[model samples]
Target: MNKKTLLFTALLVFGILQSGYTPPEEGMFPLSELHKLDLKKAGLKIDQKEIYNPNGTSLVDALVNVGGCTGSFISNEGLIITNHHCAFSAVQLASTPENDYLNKGLVAKSKEEEIEAKGLTCRITDSYEDVSNRVLGAVAQITDPSSRLQLINNTMKNIVNEAEQKDPTIKAEVSEMFIGKTYVLFRYKTILDVRLVYVPNRQIGEFGGETDNWVWPRHTGDFSFMRAYVSKDGKPTKYSKDNVPYTPKKFLKVNANGTDEEDFVFILGYPGRTFRHRPSEFITYQQKFVLPYTSELYDFQNQTMENAGKKDKRIEIKLATRIKRNANVMKNYRGKLQGLRGIDLIGQKKQEDAALAEFINNNVAEKAKYGNLMKDIDELYKVINGDANRDLWLSQIYNSTSLLAVSRNINNFKTALDAQPAAQKQGFFDQNINQVKQALSNSYSSFELDVDKTILKRMLNDAAAFSPQQKVNAVNKITSKGSNSAALIDQFIKHTFELSKLKNQDYVLNILLKNPKSISAYQDALLQLEQDLNKQIAALKPEKDRREGLLNKLMGDYVNVKEKFLKKDFIPDANSTLRLTYGYVRGYWPADATYMKPYTTIKGIIEKGATGNPDFGYPETIKTLWNAKDFGPFAKKDLNDVPVSFLYNMDTTGGNSGSPIMNANGELIGVNFDRAYGATINDYAWNESYSRSIGVDIRYVLWVATKIDKADFLIKEIGIKL
Candidate 1:
């Protein structure tokens, strides 16, 4: 389908889904409501703030932004807990066939036994300090966007320099929210002494297979344990025999008795990102086009990986973790899209925009000041839409790797007759050589020809349909053949003797071989593209300037309308730090025909098991454990051999995995893992009626640690009371 047609169809789908839903009478709650609620009224202790001191810990204490995941310190001595999935990359990189840590989990018996991950360090620098006044003050005086940004950056950097000088270990980072209207300075103490502790087996940790990912009634025990190490002097230090487990000043005690319905709970961790403040048009775009397209891409990848997984055990092992991770993300985006549709998010946004327009009309006399903001924003949206296909084209070309295609491209690069301008030469070098090298590094390790063919077919088709000027270079045709392409790539790489010669091939060939020297070449190419693409985009920006201005005005209007009509206050979705949300533990029905009750028990494991797929298969040990039927009085009849999991109204996103789900009394009851926006996109704008946080019951974690793994010593270290 054409770009416009695809966008329209997506919007139509969103409209149809949203048509039937009614907005909540109370709307969503604002941050103000959090303070008004009585702690006792929500079954929470007033002393929660005293027990779990969020402010006491510096940004360096509880907040960590790693390469792929966020982490927090749990103990004074640096005991850390994060999602198992987050730790998967480190584990995979460190493991070999003889010692596959992913298949069989790992646990360090003592501080000395802990393994230090390479190229992985947890940094917590003192980077944050309030710079809201400085930013807002500058913006108040400046009208030009470029000047405003420069002023804000300069002010923020000055603040950071001052803060960092106070503490050498401190690092400051500025976070922009509401498109730079609000800024938060994050200060952290860099902690580079992180080490692996304990992790659960893949079977128990990732139960119910791909089918249950991002869905309610989840049984995945997605938790991992790690301890922070420091020098003998009790300061953060790198890996060394002299290092010891850093004792935390405070570590949460594991509460064996879990929480019930309507209990007040809170999660303290680094939540990645949320788009709650995005303009309505942008939200509409996501609901209609972006999410579905992403979901399609993920689905393709999953299928390709799964098919290849079956032939080679190694492939299965390598791809299994990635598939599950991507599946959850895909499910999340799909659910968010659906949620956006169901709640008529765009309609609500439009209503809010109208209200804001009225407010501006009544309060502001200068039409020139606010009138064109909405128009400009609309124009910006249109301009962005024109270039949206660029990403799709790029994705297709980057995701494929066929050996023959690479060989042909390499040969072409070697023999290209044209010596273009310096700028053009650099552009080709960056686009063709550098990117391919990076792709090859990651893709070569897990190469599968059949998988490449499937991805290539989709990408090639997409590229072929691209606007003539926007199409990717033509190496795709050569690699379109499955095994035939692989043979060709083999011959090309073998015949090419010198690295210098290989680097000079035409764009297509340079990309295939995964050349090492392409990095420098890519730098040159990138500079060329940046200048060209920027100039092209800059030209279109002015055409839609009027519309873009309108959209911004509309955004303000929507916010005002939401405040007037929607009773529930809308707070910015969680961004790590500490957040408290209260709601009853309840099950949800995702579709009319299916009800996902809140929990998955051990029996479900046996029922879902298949010998062919290890992901779906329950290990013999777990199966035997289930047959034993060692149930205490806690097992309910409704659960009937099924496991009982709880659902809560807590707001969470990607980085919240392994977050401690604590009761009002500050007792740990569950581990926050995933969200249930599998079929809907409600997370983008939480519709309390639907979006719910899914977590593994804390009781299960204790059971697994004490019963399953028999790590009584480690459990005792965490102060688990049975």
Candidate 2:
């Protein structure tokens, strides 16, 4: 076998082993089968009889179409509430370094004081009508892939255009699922005027630090506040001092006294994405190869950046956020790998594959069309396994640095364009020149350069034996001190500048002037590196196809494997639209010797405090709360001395963040923040036996707001009714 083929085989073997399955048992879900029970039936819940729906709100009312985690009004006036992290970028952009709003947090003292964020918008008004027949009628008989894709896109575009024309204020988007089996056209009324309302300091918001990202038994006050603004006439408008505070028809009231175990809860937000429908082989590939490689890349970046951060305080501050973000993702991927191992995912997948194969055998036409597609997918896995390591190295090094190359290339394009036709030249300059400048202006600084170089060197060294091209280029560029570096960069800048000038566009000039060749080089290098990596990936296709076919055959053979053994129960994710997952609030043991209890109190913060770590340090106010024998009604146990943390088995994911975890009677208990370690893989497949949701008691938010921040007015506005 070639090196790529060998690598593919090795990854397949590793995946099977990591998933805790023997060869024959690979790809089998011993616990349950597909289609035996309805996921909607298992997961959905509605409060139709109630005056208001507690399980979920309308997608329109919640403003689900808005940018990450923003909401809108059911009433004529707009009012929005979203997570703090979701609004961080807008906050950062609006605040100066001197102000550092993120550090101190921000609260609009009144409607007049609220700051309008630039380019900030919240959209609503999606209208979905079934046009399945209209879309598929013409192409129902077409078998060509390109034709099908084009047909789908054309249909979607037409729908979106029609929707946009009906309401000029509305933005439209089209989503396709099940390989065009379903299409949804979403129309949204854009609310461009938004203002900051309230935010808690990083200390309170991200309490657990790197130690408690995805794990439950948790305490993190991950919440933020924002309100919508409208024109004087009460219609959505651009930022203006004249705009009035929007009054929402219905907004969730703050329930100070939180709920206990088995209470119903729900969340509404724009969840980014999930890979629930990915093929079993793809899942296995990610578990064994992709995730591990990516984790290693993050670790390398973290260490390199952290080391640099220590030298310069500013660097430290800048990289601190990046490190934290990367660390969170790294922790998630690690937990995901562990979850895959613990669940024997490969074994279950194999069983499902067998059943699928048997089904295909029974259906001749289905077998002929889908059989090759399955084979191709398996080949894709093998290719992925073969290229995993190179892909990681390139991603960390060349891919990350490709911006530099792109800048250079853009400059070259400008130079070449001078001789081209006027119309084409004007178009090119108008479009490309401005973008180049923006990229350069935002390029990583010199402090970051050292860190990037360190990672690049490490990655190049790893690939030295396998691929000499990168190492050769690195040596030629750095050691030889090639004059072409600066000259080429200058040429790139000049070309872009000239292009911008020719186009007579200020925006074009701004972009070209800001982005230098170094940044462009980084971007170009990434593309080339990816191309090389793909060559390696392409080599493992044949063997991969065979393995995939085998797995499919196995699934078909054991079609009813899961239904025959495991109990018929499964739930879908908490879509912002509506969902209900009923389970008792209980403590869970993640590992053999590690037990995560049901709740964490304020005292736990004091106990876990490290004076040196700003993230973990207790504020003076919290210390006072501890010093005083002031255990309020919400305090549990005689352990005012003991800090509290809670864990419960409730289904939740990204959208569930900031959801109200309520009691059986629908009283607010806690704010959902994250999932326990065992549940991180719930994104892939939920295991009711172990997966749990972690939430911060609503009482904590009250305590922080009243005692720490002393924001009495804001607290009162939340309708605390205390």
Give each prediction's root-mean-square deviation over alpha carbons: 10.1, 11.0
The window of 10 residues in a row where model 2 has the poorest summed lDDT is 23-32
Best-fitting candidate, scored by lDDT: 1
| Cα lDDT listed for each candidate | 0.58, 0.55
Residue 502 deviation, candidate 2, in Å?
21
lDDT tens digits, residues 1-722, model 1? 23654575466446545665322312123222344444454455645345333457422235455534555555555666666776776677667778888778887777676777644566543334456777668656765555555666687787778767876676777665333444577766555676777788877766666667776666677777777677888787778877877765455655666764444576655566676766676877776667887788878888889889888777776666567766876777777776776778899877766665665566555344566555665666766666566544454443443433344333345334135464576556556665555543444445565675567556545544567545444423333456564554344333322222323334424453334344334423222322333344455555445344344334544444445445544554445433345544555556676655556676666666744655676558767766776543334454545243568766667766666677766656677777775424534666555677887776666666665677776766766644
Put down candidate 2 lDDT per residue, 1-722, tens digits, no spaces. 23654575466557556756432101111111222322222222433222133233432244433344434332233444455566665666566557767667787777777776644676554444556566666567755545555666687788889988987777777654223444455655566788777777877777777776785645566666666777878787888888787655444545666654333344333433345544578688788777887787788888888899788756665555457667877888898898888888877877766666566556677566455545555765776666566555544553344333333344455445655675676565557755555554434322265564456555544554344332334323332344544444334334433432223223334443344332232323433433444444455445444444344333322222323323432222223332333344566556677756566777667766745655575456777777794645556543443334456666566655555555544444565667888878876776556777776776776677676777777766666655
Q: Model 1, residue 122: displacement in angstroms?
A: 3.7
